[model samples]
Target: MFGFGIYDALIIAGFLGLQFFLSARNSAYWGAIIPVLFISWLTWLLVSGEIKSILAYLLILSIGFIVLLLEWSEGRKALRNRREKELAKMRSYDMN
Candidate 1:
């Protein structure tokens, strides 16, 4: 369908990228992505005038939220792993 054209496809990719960048715990890039994303959505709304289509975009945001959760848990796991590694190293050093 025309609704899912090349432009829409690109926007979908960008939405996912934005989610990853945001969930990466990196704030430096948000300044670049936030305005662009907001304006893109605004322009798309004005041009499309299809309220029903917003649900699809919102679904992308939902996916972004899920990504954020995953990233947070991953960060916790990594931190725990690092601590365990440090403890192992300390114990080996004491044995030596």
Candidate 2:
């Protein structure tokens, strides 16, 4: 199981949920906080030696990064779509 315990799994799951929530909020402050939290958690793990294996640590980091990237891209896509819709509405009004 790559040295992952129940604790590690639960923490990762929680972070994933946090990432999703922050992405959905789409605020500048919240957007900045996720990466900081991610880094702090990893640093704490490394310092506390909770995870012994290097492979396990890397795997955890990779999973977190992938989830964060996916959620961020999705958020951006949604924002773009919303902006495009608003622009279209304004253009229609101008034409009318």
- TM for every model, in the order presented, reads 0.44, 0.70
The number of the candidate with the highest TM-score is: 2
* lDDT, candidate 1, 7-96, per-residue tens: 978986676555545534434343345445555765586458744466656665566556545554554455567678999999999999
Model 2: residues with Cα > 4 Å off, grouped in runs: 1-30
The ten-residue window of minimal lDDT in model 1 covers 23-32
Worst 10-residue lDDT window, candidate 2: 23-32
Provide the overall lDDT of each model, using Cα atoms, as 2-decimal numbers. 0.58, 0.73
**Clashing pairs in model 2, backbone N/Cα/C closer than 3 A:** none
lDDT of 2 by residue, 3-92 (tens): 679998998777766665666564745655777778688768877887777777788788777778887667666667778899999999
Q: Predict model 2's lDDT versus the native.
A: 0.73
**lDDT leader:** 2
Q: Kindly provide the TM-score of model 2 when superposed on the true structure, using C-alpha atoms.
A: 0.70
